[model samples]
Target chain A: MQEILQYLFSGITNGAIYAVIAIGFSMLYNSTELINFAHGEFVMLGSLCMVTFFGSMHLPLVPAIILTITCVALAGLVFERLAIRSVKHPEPIVLIIITVGASIFLRGIGMIIWGKDAYSIPSFSSHPPLDIAGAKLLSQSIWIIAIFLVAAVGLQLFYKKTLTGKAMEANAISKRAAWIVGIPSKLMVMMAFGLSTAMGGLAGVIIAPITMSSYDMGTMLGLKGFCAAMLGGLGSLWGALIGGFLLGILEALGVGFVSSGLKDATAFLLLLFILYVRPGGIISSADVNRF
Target chain B: MLLVKRYRSMMMILSVLAIACLLVASPAISASGKKPYKIGGIFAVTGPASFLGDPEKKSMEMVVDQINAKGGIDGHMLEAVIYDTEGDPSKAVMGVSKLINKDNVIAIIGPSRTPTTLAVMPMIQKAKIPFISCAAGNKIVQPIDPWVFKTAQSDILAVAAIYENLKSKNIKKIGIISVNNAFGESGKEQLLSQAPAFGLAVSKSETYGAKDTDMTAQLTKIRQDNPEAIVCWGTNPGPAVLAKNIQQLGLDIPLYQSHGVASPKFIELAGSAAEGIMLPTGKILVAALLPDSDPQKEVLNAYTSEYEKKYKSSVSGFGGYAYDAVKILAAALKNSNGDKEKIREALENTNGYVGVSGIFNFSKTDHNGLSPEAFVMVKIQDSTWKLLQ
Candidate 1:
């Protein structure tokens, strides 16, 4: 009834955020074949940057959003150049380890800059909640869902229609082949990091009003986003969307019908069960090149 | 042979001068006629609980400095040896052991949070050093260890304050949601145990992780039960999130927060959603609003003004715990002359000393020395605390 619908709305709101983070994960994984562990820190920086821009600086919403995304995207590029590219050995495990170190470094920097207090910004619009069948939906939740849709559609079109996007896709399929095809694989990797971090930043900005933002907020969000990416079969774009929503819905339902205390355990247990059964993911078969 | 003898004689002079310098620099022999009384402080000054420990550390140092400036406690100037616990139990234990065995402090105060305090309790008892904890858990003093005392109002008192307010409002069948941590767990225990006494029934009990981002689902579930009021217990961010989630979900019933959120930081984090949210807290938040005839009015005004002037920040009740703890220790030191056993005995016999948190009355069986009256109910109005009448 109304309660179920309410849980669904709540799930979708969180699901959209997880979906954005998962796509960020998938982007870097595709181009570099390296999971960017610091991707979540990009999200943290994004949210905090928005707090500084929109909350403290008192800039209008759209400009603040653009500045936040550009700032995080630049940070992503610098991180790639400094941490990822400076590695002596280009081994995947070594690069992943570097990203892990980068994440800790970024988190420490974030703490120093922002301190440990949690801060919130005003929502995109100051409208009242929309009542649908007795379940309340904030205007910000609608904006989040719309933003997710736009990002998904925009990314799909970019990959299908643009030369750079296709080059990045080709690089994901095979680095040697992409190089042979004159894709400039190194540039593609750098572009992937920038694009993914921008997306993560956007997610952080939108969700800040809801979740509030702090130095350590990125760790859990990043972990959950990684879970969503894996559940969506890693590199599958649409699959990430579905996986994020599914995880969110499952968590909400678990908290609603089952014990609330075991909410995280429930989502993770389902994740383990799915990974064991499918070995790939729910939508793994749809994306042949991902494997 | 003559040149070597001259160099050796100069080296001997230099060695004697260095030894004299070392002796002059050593703390054992001070310029003061009497030996300084060394008091140990353990606080989580640089970690997640820094909000509590930072202020506690500052206030304790401020008290010590003020005491030393006025000559000394019976000609023995107070020296504070403080260590950062980083909110970790192992670190706290390490700090306390060093404070006891290495520094040989006659008395110790604080290890900030409940878990750290509990971790180091047995060791303090074994060492037989006078300890005053700043954590609010009832278990710290419930068993009444002769060596351990605390200044923070126990969770039982805060719970009683909440239930008393609920009783006055004729509210029954309240839902309880608490963060799943030591502070929340202790508050939840008191809320459940004392509900029956207040003729209140806890319709639903739920818990959320400390770092949870959203709590809409939990509130939705609570809404199904339709409790008269909801009590959410946790420190900042989680309770702030819960407040925002409750607003988003439009669960319009009365919402009560724990004393954990009794800070301006909570108001800023919760934003407009903080309106009308009530909690039991120390009188420091509403010291300006207290009537003149109140017992704690003068002390609260002095401590708040002094702390705010010194620290350049609004005074928090968490710091008041340390302020009261140091004042209580100084009272004991006055009676004992820095004797450890005498300090312990003196602390156990403290009577009617007005301080920031409350009037103190300690006994052998009751080491905490404050009642439920230590807490007052306050509501958030317009992003500020409004003392509840």
Candidate 2:
């Protein structure tokens, strides 16, 4: 049905954002063995970066976006080196607490810097709604989906083809082994953190025009991304993709068929159900524990 | 011996003079003139609810500045002490206690959200200090405590306006989407309980949390019900998310929302989808939709211009309510000459006090100043609200 198609397309667009954020979460979890709860704050900082350098200063979109990503990536490096590196050998719970503390600290700093106001980024294109088979889709949605797909494919190729990418994989598997094999494990972990933060920043920039930007915007997105990552089996990149898209479509369908108020609860309930049936997520069990 | 005696006497005199100066400058010794009338403001100044409180704080600051510029009330400068409730209720009770017992404020202005107001109500009643709530929940003013009054219209009045508008449009079936919080629950109760009386049927109901982003699954189910209208009742960001999801799902039916979505940020967040969405609000907002010659025009214009100049942004109904609250408080102060009991009586006896929002007629039974008649339906046109007939 036309309504079904609309929900599907909208779901994909929203799913793309979740997918992008989840990719970062996946990379950080794989390499550092830390959940990086502050990963969401990186996205928020990226959006705030746009507001500061572009929105307030009226810079061109391209340079503004580049500056935002660079700033966010650098912030991730500083966070990892200063806050995360010290707790690398601590209890896993301590690492989680540290990341959560980082998240709160970043949120507080953002509030003080930006104040509490919502801001929007201008859409990249001025095209009218694209109608296909009784379904209407905005040009912005296409941009978001395209950017997400390109980033995913690009990351895949980088990991498969580049020497640095293999080093990160080795580092993720066993840091002591990677160091014995001359992999420079610490640098690989730092690189993984940088790449993940950049991806989050890019997601922030791409979605800013659609959802607008606010200090608290990243918290919900972060939770949804974590859910998507878990649904896909956190260790599998492809699973993250499928899980994110599936979750998005399910939410869209829930809102379309059920009440809007129950949409979130439905998504969470679906997540619980998925976990019950497939404890390793939608992905195969072999891939679940691969990391 | 005579010289030594003279020098010793001079040094003692100097020391006594220095001690005398310190005593005169101390707070305890300077309490001779009329004591400053302290007014406490409990607001959500630092959290998610800061958006509502920041403007109210600015308005109060402006009002206080103007009042003092004209040489304080009854020759005593008004002192406004504030407590940041952080939009939490338990903290609000503590805030009330601190304001009443420690700061000794004669009156308190708010604990902005509904739950916070409800939490602090007991403390206010126990202390018998006049407290005016700035929140829109009708339940805040009910059971009409003699010391409690509200500057904003109630949720019941807002729902009644929407119901009447639905009738005018001949839309009979409506789906309801609300948050799980106190504000949303109260709205849900009002709509479900009062819709039958207005000849509207509840087609479906959905609920979401404050932090939810995706609501498509719920929207899809509601679409299956094929309701004529979707009535969303929640604060900002929630309603905006619903609007985006509704548009994305291609549910083109009329989306009727609570007054909370009247902010420009809602339109910005909802994007082009915000167009044609209908909501009911007080006259202070959507003022341009009213006739130019209306008596309330001057007040609206003055508030709009002054607020824009002061805050560098457009004014919302929340700011208008704060403006009106200050005016009402000033009127009471003028009448009672800073007598707390007499001011409470004057506030309780407030009748026909024309404000930008509506004509406030507070009585012993009703603490909310406005009725359903005070609202007008407005639709978003090009990111701005236009009156809908």
Candidate 3:
């Protein structure tokens, strides 16, 4: 029972991180009809930049983090201008291929900058594990979960209150309609890419203390996050949150109850089961086609 | 129409003649005295395992430069053809083919990580080129492939070393958490097979994937088993994550790592969590700390100093693996004078060649040439390796 509880806690912590990545995927899919496959590289750049600017350059953590996010956001913008915008007309498959190419390009650049070493980010706190009943949770994990919640809520509020966020939503509804209303749909798509990457970067910096940062770190993680996004119905934000946790918990339980080797398999198998049951995601309803 | 047919036939004849001319000139160019004894290197100079490959490349380059400066092998300038495998098996295949077919290398040095070494060894053996590996895996040398030799001690030696220490502590039951890769799988096989011989039992074993970010779930399962110690087998990032997860869980068991994580990069990635984790590794790590009378001390010391001085960076055990491999290859080269068959025979008969790793003694049956004595168990103390008594 204690072991079960322990796995549960760890699962949630990991789920939160995956949720963060999935949310970025969901956000981009929400505003722009295309998914940025380079989303994971944004995460990699965030933590790698922090390791350089914050850890190596010995800057204050706050400014280092800010600059890291700005760098990652700019990287996302570059991907947009160079790869996405250059496509005269893009099908979904074409967009995916372009974004994956951008991902590889970013990874190559990361290799040059970081020299293929796995680097670490020191945790925000050095305290011992907080014992929740019989299960122990790292304070860094708590920070991860808290940060995920804050980001989710903050995004929610921004989408509801801000004009730019509304414009993004308008573009998502119909690009032609948004352009007719003078919303500048193309800029909205670019901003969605930028905002999504910023969120992904934040996730990377926060979780990198636990998972060390490397140049190719984003490939598998991006795959998993994409899984969570697809499971949650790509068009739904809340679906991403629930789907991330679901994938994380199922994977953890698989490790605990079933074979540890089958954790990834178990998660994918569950996705298959869910897809069989509901074409839309767990939180996704029949009418959740809008942003 | 007749003119066009005549022109096409002439072009085809010219192309065939060109190909025949190139093929006819290849052997004469390769056999020349100026065409130095070529050695090809396939290391993961960039990508996930660059920590291992990058160092190996630098060490090989250093060794090559030193050998040439002292005057080339048998007065023939030594030429090295190196290809970056990027830790991929297919890249290793590509590189090895190019070396054998194009570069005309008589010897192949490394494909730094275990899987790449395994992938390319059979090819080298078939080609009858003397292949020396720098990775640790018993399977690399197990079947007695006559053409292949390894510098780094095998995983069998690592398992024995860890079991030796565990026996001293009187620990009977053990747990293992190995990554799901060739290196970890090989380590797990040795640890399980060798445990019973040393009066130990593997109680529970868990595994993680290559890119797993969190190991808490697996570690938690291992913790529940309540074994004497948990042996984590993997390379960087995975094992480092294990250290952090173990620290976070406050698991009180003594952690033992495989030689795979026996480098400063492990400590750097693991951070404070690395404190007190013990592992068996090559003496390159503790060369400075070795007593004067130690057999490996002088060679390790000289190699580390020269490498550190040349590269302007700290030496790693991975680099020492390549350094040892090249030393053995150079010894064989000196004995055979770059004859491929003679080099293979010479490498097979090598005896008491003191390398940075250990004293190598190759024989008809044993290509690995080192034993359990090659490994020195060290513990991470204050974020650096300390020789465990």
The best candidate by TM-score is 3
**Taking the tens digit of each residue's C-alpha lDDT, what string does model 1 give over B207-243?**
8888777788899898888999999989988999999
Against the native complex, each candidate's DockQ, computed on alpha carbons, is 0.27, 0.19, 0.36
Error of 2 at A189 (Å): 2.0
Mark the regions of model 2 whose C-alpha exceeds 4 Å error after superposition: A1-6, A50-65, A86-90, A126-138, A256-259, A273-291, B1-32, B207-219, B225-227, B241-253, B288-293, B334-339
Candidate 3 displacement at residue A111 in angstroms: 1.4
Relative to the real complex, the DockQ score for model 1 comes to 0.27
Question: Native contact fraction of candidate 2?
Answer: 0.36
- In model 1, pairs of residues that clash are none
Global Cα RMSD, each model: 8.3, 9.7, 7.0
Candidate 1 accuracy as TM-score: 0.92
Docking class for candidate 3: acceptable
Superior by TM-score: candidate 1 or candidate 3: 3
Clashes of 1: 0
